[model samples]
Target: MSEVAENIKTTETVAVQPKKPAEPLLSKRRKRLMSDPLDEDNPITVQVLGICSALAVTTQMKPTLVMAIAVIFVIVFANLIISVLRNLIPNRVRIIVQLSVIASLVVLVDQVLKAYFFDVSKLLSVFVGLIITNCIVMGRLEAFAMGNKPYDSILDGLGSGLGYSWIILAVAFFRELFGSGAVFGFPVFESLGLAYENNGLMVNSIGAFLIIGLIIWAQRWRNGYVEHN
Candidate 1:
C-alpha cells in the first residue's frame, strides 16, 4: 500500500510540472521600427523603385546630397502623419487620405526649398513635385505604417529613405567627376588642356542613366548576384 501511494504521488507531481511557453512574435509596431535596408528587400537596389529621381538629380554631388536629405525628411514625416491618423481614416477613402497627407508634406518641402535655395529648386523643377509619386513612400504607408505606431513607422521610413540617398550620392560622385570634369561644381581638370573646350558629358540626362546603371551593376556583382564571367 505504501509503495502504491508513493507511485501515485510521483505521477501527480510529474503531471503538475509546468511547461514553458514559447516566445511571443514581435509586435507589428516593433517589426516596422527594426527592419534593415541592405537586404534583398531594399526599395532602390532590389525592388528597382524610384529610379527616375535616381537618374535625374544625381548629376552633381551637392544637388544629389540635398535631394537625398529632402527625401528622408518627407518620407519620415509622411509616415508618421499617416500612422497617427490611420484609425481615423475611413477604409473606403484611406488611399485618398494618404495622398492628401503626402501631398501636403511635399508642398511644404518644395516651399522651403524655393525660399532658401531658389536656384537649386529651379534645377530640381518637376522632380521635387514627383516626390509625391515615389513608390517607397506609398509602399510604406500601405505595408507597415498603417498598422504601426507613429514612431516606428517614422524610423522605417527614414531608414529606407537614407538607404536610397546613400546610393544616389555615390552615383553622383562618379558622374560629376568623370562626366563634368568637376567635383562639387569645382572644375578639377582645367590643367588637362583637353581638345574639347566644354564639359559636354555632364549636361545631358543620358550620362546620369549610364552612371546609375554602372553603380547598380557593380553592387550586384559585389553581392554575388552577377558573376565576373
Candidate 2:
C-alpha cells in the first residue's frame, strides 16, 4: 500500500508539471527597440553621432557596405556581451570595461577585414580602427545594454547599427554613382548610355559634406523634425 501510494504521488507530480510561458520575439516594446533607431531616433541624422565614418567611408558603396557590416557585427555582439556581464562589472570601471570590450571587437573586425577583404581594409584604413571611438557603440552599451535584458539590448544594437548603415550607404550610392559614373564598380551611366562626365567634386571630401548636409535636411524635413527654441 505504501509503495502504491508513493508511485501515485510521483505520477501526479510528473503530470502536474507546468510549462514555461512563451515570450513574443517582437513584442510592441521590442519592435520599438528594433526600429526606432532607423529614422526617428537615428544615430546619425537625428542624434548627430558617428558623423566621421559617415563622410570618410562613404565615397564608394563597396567599402561603405563592408564598413556597415563591420559596425553591425561589432555593436550587436558587444551589446550582447556587455549586457551579459552588466551585473558582474563594477560601476566605477564601467566605461573602461565598455571601451575594452569595444576595442577587442574592433580588433577582431579589423583582422577579418584584413584576411578576406584586404583592399577594403586599406580603403577603410584607420576608420575601421576608429570604430573603437564611435559614440553610438559606446552610448548604446552605456545607455541601453546596461539597464536592459539581453534580448532587448540586442534589438537596440541592431536598430542603431542599421540606422547608421542605411544613411552611409545612401551617401555612398550617390557619391560612387556620380563620382565614378558607376554603382558598386559597375558602369551604370555608361551601361545606360547616358552621356555623363565623372564629377570630380563628388570624389572629394567637399562632396561628402554636401551629400551628408542634404541628407540631414531631407530626413528632418520628411520626418517633420523641427527644432524649436
Candidate 3:
C-alpha cells in the first residue's frame, strides 16, 4: 500500500512538471504585430505625416490612385527587405541602407508607372520619385519593421501605406470633384450645367491646398484632435 501511494504521488508530480509553460516567442511576436504603428495611430491620418503628395497628385483621380498603389508597393517591399537584412546592417549606417532600399524600390515603381501609364506618369513627374522622401516609408523601417519578424514587418508596411493611400484618395476625391467638375475623368456636373468645362478650380494648386486643409480639419474634428475655435 505504501509503495502504491508513493508511485501515484510520483506520477502526479511528473505530469505537472512536463506541462510546458507558454512560449514567450510567439506571444512576443504577436504583441509586436498588434502594436505596430499602422493601425493604432497612422502617420497620415493621425499624425498627418505625408501631406505633400496629397496636395500634389490629387488634382486628378488616376494619378492619385496610381500614386497610392506605388507607395503601397514601395513601402511593403522596402520593409520586407529591410527586415530581412536588419541583422547585417551596421548600426552606424542603418539609415543609409534603409534609404538605399527605399530609393531602389521607388525607382522601380517609377519605371513601371512610366512604361504603362505614360500620360498619368507625366502628370505625376517628380512627385513619384519623391515617394522615397515620404515619411511613412522611413518611419516604418525605423519604428516597427527594424526589430520585428519579416511577416509582421510586411503587414505593418502595408497597413501604413494603405492608411496614407486612403486619406490621399479621399482628399483627391474632394479636390477633383469641386475643382474640376469631374470624378476620375468622368464628367459628372455637365448634365446639371454646373461644370466648369475648362481650367476649373480642380486644376490649380490653391484648390488642393484648400481642400487638404479642410480635410485635415475634418479629420481632426472627427478624431477630437482639434476643437472648434
What TM-score does each of the candidates earn? Answer: 0.76, 0.88, 0.77
For residues 1-229, write the lDDT of model 3, one tens digit per residue. 5643443343224334433773343356555454443434656656667877877788878889999999989988998888777666788999989999999999999898888889988989999999999988998898866776566677677778877887778778877777777789887788677746555666677777777677667766766765349
Compose the digit string of candidate 2's lDDT tens values, residues 58-161: 88999999999999999998998887777767999999999999999999999998999899999999999999999999999999988766677888999999
Give the clashing pairs for model 3: 179-201, 179-202
Candidate 1 lDDT tens digits, 1-229: 5643443343324324424452133445445454555443567777788888887888888888878888888888888887777666788999888888888999998999999999888878888888899887888898877886565676788778877887788778877877777778887676565543444575567777777677677767776774347
Candidate 3 wrong stretches, greater than 4 Å: 1-40, 192-202, 226-229
lDDT order of candidates, best first?
2, 3, 1
- For model 1, give the RMSD to the true fold: 13.0
Which candidate achieves the best lDDT against the true structure? 2
Candidate 2 total steric clashes: 0
Q: Which lDDT values do the candidates have, in the order given?
A: 0.75, 0.88, 0.76
What total of clashing residue pairs does each candidate reach? 0, 0, 2
